[model samples]
Target: MKHIKFSISLLLLLVFASCEKELDLQPQQSIGIDAATATPENINGILLAAYDIGRNTSPDNLAPLYNGNYSGYLNISSELLGNTDQVSWNGTFDYLRDIFNKALINNNTGALNIYSDSYAIMGHVNTVLANLDKFDDAAERDRVEGEAKFLRGIVYFDMVRFFGQQYNPAGNNSQLGVPIILTPPDVSIRIERNTVEEVYTQVISDLTDAFAKLPDDNGARADKYAAQAILARVYLQQGNYTGARDAADNILQNSGHSLTATFAEAFDTDDNPSETIYSWVITQQEGTNISNTHYATEALGGRGGDIAITQAYLDKFDSDADQRRNFTYPGEGVSTGLLLTSKHVRQFANATPVRIAEMHLIRAECNFRLNSSVGLAPLDEINALRARSSAPALGALTLDLILNERELELAFEGFTLHDYKRTQRNIGTLSWDDNKLVFPIPQSARDRNPLLEQNPGYN
Candidate 1:
């Protein structure tokens, strides 16, 4: 994997040069601020660049590392960590080992990559937002602005959740979060962290505006429902059950999206299933490295068996009836007897960002929390997802039951860690308030900007 050089000064120039080449225009040796913001085509290219960063992966920059491996989406076997019971990677990468162990350091490469890549993408989005007047057509300008805000909202949400403590609505969320860079900063600027409350305020503000301005029909791009879905998630994280329930209800009532008839059909890589609200488009010509990370072995056409499923996690499935369990294959990689997830078996499998099933779960949880049978009973919502998989429906619902369903239904799509942290649930031996659960700001970043403070518990 190749890492792209990223910095505020360089990003401006690269955005212009890349857009010029993408539009088949002569490569400009120099780009002025005015020229970069003057054309619709130029702004569109910048937006595309923002989307492009979501797939970035490398030892130093692993934006794609979020949901799958680190969140226990797949079980990993590595000799570097000293576990020899299962098949493991023979290579010695301290960063990978540290992340898997839930013992991250300030200098970890994977954490640095996520921080850098997220902010880099945010920089592009900020550039677009700052130049909304550049577009002559009002509708085009609104659409672009909406999409930029949606991206910004999600990136900030991702960063805050990782760098700060979990949101505590009752406590006012005063814990420090990542710096909020709404507009691109000057080359000399240094930033301090915002409170978690402040970050969520901005996320909700951006997404609220995005939901209003975004068109309903932007295929594969940020659409209205995507913003709504994310807004619901943000509310849920904050423990605003009513807000989450309302936002999710809005999507269910208005958004045409629905679940696929079968669990297997929902994951088809060839097309965006009806369940998908938004997905990172992966085409044959250009695909993701997820297959290599999670499924790669001689049997799976990957370089090595980088990740496998733990028997403990697999046991969560009902062996007698759950159809989703079929997606797992007995591992043939380094973990020869373990189970490997086949969800992203192909290199070109599209990455689902938000799906309709999540909306159902959010609504279910929110309703359960409020103890009001507002839209749908929590039991019905849980049953809806279970019925699709042929799992036995529960006669009653509890917070524990809903969370268990979430663990099984939403596993590997990146919500596990956040769910645990926000709900104050423990994962294995790690508690919700554990310092290890929140990643330290990379040492490289702190060294560059004197004002940047390290997260507590890291030197």
Candidate 2:
């Protein structure tokens, strides 16, 4: 695929690891200046940066995007290269750092604004919560406070995942993750990484409060159901099976969300379908280099192809019944077998987070992991998805199959690598080597923080 040139389009191509965290260029000025005194409109403008970063973190450009897409392509190749789908310089990881690195080097304080942006909103929440008297009406204060909390929760949640380990209840405190920057950290705060569990605990706490603060549904923004779904994902990663199962079940039962009948329509971009629980809006940029749908086409376009799905990933849904097969079409001039990702095909529209279907799948996995005796729940969930593929449901469900299916079903949505980490699946391996399982903690992080430690086996 042709490499898309970095231009003004690329400047607006803000990349986020998730809705929760971001990489900010060092600020020219401290975030400590009291933004609390700003008018509500200015505060809202500050908050928009968080949302902007969240929207730009397209699944196509995330690290796993390269991993899943290119690896999937290589798996189909008969050559079986030792270098299959690996992100060795010419991959998703490289593109991901482009925006942040540029911003860092140029000292673009605009990027640094995300830190203050998030807390500035949080400050609004605090202001409202602490001084309901300022708002004249209790309902207005409560609603505004809830919106602030939801934004805060989403931002923190994203950061924790990118900068820290997956939440492992058994060893949470021992896990070094992102430093908790709840309030704008003071210049002398000298941040330290918190335990993964602590980060997750705070996320859960923030979301839990958000659920109470939010209504049942909030149109395009996050609502009670979105918070619940996020909480369920956090629980699953933490090995809190019951919590995951319950949170998921609550959404399925109470939130009026449901899966679209066919897999093809599920991800269509022309209109925002009902299944998206929460998402950030993206304005279509014609020349933007990072369109996820263009993944398959980009490489063949001649600029430069960073990653394309391997044949193995395509083969996962080779069954005639799988409707997802039709959704994936070959990019122009591409070889026959490589399938381009069809998950986000909009010429331009907002990205949607999974609504009901994802939560249902989470419940099934949680129950399956808990070894539920009913068995029917997992079967039912699998069948629901299988029905979309037009494939028959397989025999008994196992964590392995569910894990594999989740990858197949949600390949480019940015969960693959993290899921691999959380489940402790062997990463960095073509075969069954354990050494490739965890990422080397950026050596730079260790050099900066003496208390930081690397994942086992990396050294």
Candidate 3:
């Protein structure tokens, strides 16, 4: 006979409180913490929380920087297409700043607060890791740790890129990057900053550990390849061409993942295709604006009113053969000659991967940088994709061609601005000032931690 369970645990209260949010989007303090004190189930809940960060937000979800809104802001295609006419501060800039300010700093940190919520998530994961030895099931325990590490590394990767400079492995040690908060920081332990190198080292360490501990096919919850894919990106940013290539090679060899055959089908408006390795499944929530859901739609249609796609990106596509041209939707308005972004025209409710496909492009770019000969293979890779789209194949590959291909292929996928930085290309004569190149360290963060210094060129 099953016994009736009747016990009150503070852990349950803590977990419940941790998940609940106030209107301000911060967590309501938990009343009891005893249940979570040393329990494996509670440990898993914390890991789950970490996975939730970066899933929803205005910048990724509704900024002109990556999605359809490139029309108004010159900063976008400026470096990509060598056009510098449209870079201006609109809602996208304010949205990104507000998001960083609210989630990273505001007291009511929760699922909405990407930064502080991430710290809370890290807390949960670290707690589980500290108590891993106590779990009865080894596989279960190991999986939990792996997920935690994956989430930690992912957040750190984003932090360094958005708040600090891109990882220059050579300069990371002295460069001001985000604080390397491994475990929870107390008043005393709260850090000022780590060199971009130090932060990257920790990112790689966590991802490496995750790679070893994570399962091969665990479905969306952080597996080995996902960690490897992210690590490949980290390596690419650090200009470790060999490291990036090897990491990409490891995935190509060990994982069954492959690029989608056709450009149109690859980025088709349906939900995420087979190519997605990992994605924050954008679940439908009440009050979540469909237009504000994807970067493409928001960038294209939002109040930002950035410049529309120019003839340059359009010219890259073989107009007659490529179906993506339809997605660009020309003649919608006086300013919007290209009415809609083809990659994402549907409602945002459809579940999709936040990181995929473009990674292959990133891998190819890393290879290209390491050895220009390797560029041929990546060019072939993209051409293979173009051929599937029924577009005419190019005669030969060049850096400019590859760069343009990346812009055409990964447009509005959040890499347009950052990629410009990575390639060290100028955004033409009319676009960004020195201030737009790097984000300021933010006055709020500076006030809290006096040790923090603003990024040069921003002040």
Which has the greatest lDDT?
Answer: 1
Best by TM-score: 1
**Global fold similarity of model 3 (TM-score):** 0.74
Clash count, one per candidate:
3, 26, 21
Candidate 2 RMSD to the correct structure: 8.6
Off by over 4 Å in 2: 1-36, 57-134, 285-305, 333-338, 373-376, 428-459
User: For model 1, how does the per-residue alpha-carbon lDDT over 1-459 read when each residue is reduced to its tens digit?
Assistant: 111221122334343333211111122356566666677877776786667666532223322322222112211211112122222333356776676676777887667766766776676788788888778899998899999999999878878887888898797678899888877534555778888889999999999999999999786687888898999999999889999999998898888888889887776355677888887665544335454454545555554456555655667776568877666776564657656666656565565547788899999999998997667888998898999989998888889889878877866566667777778866556677788777788887777676788887898
Provide the clash count, candidate 1: 3
Q: Candidate 2's residue-wise lDDT over 426-458, tens digit each?
A: 443432223232233444334444554555444
lDDT per residue for candidate 3 within 1-459, as digits (tens), equals 011111212333235223322111222455334445457766665555444332332222322111212111222322223333322212234444333232222221111233344455455555557767667998998788888788788767766765565554455257677767665323345356787778888999999999999999876566888899889878877778788777777776567766666655555332455566664444333112222332233444333223345555566665566655444654233334334455544443322343445555666666666654332377776676566556678777667877776776666555665566566666554232233444455554455567766666534
Candidate 3, residue 107: the lDDT equals: 26
Off by over 4 Å in 3: 1-34, 57-120, 169-173, 185-188, 267-271, 285-308, 315-320, 330-338, 349-356, 372-376, 428-435, 457-459
Question: How well does candidate 3 score on lDDT at residue 265?
Answer: 55
Q: lDDT per model, in order?
A: 0.69, 0.51, 0.53
All candidates: CA RMSD in angstroms?
6.3, 8.6, 7.8
Model 1 stretches with alpha carbons more than 4 Å out: 1-29, 57-92, 296-303, 333-335
Residue 431's lDDT within candidate 1 is 76
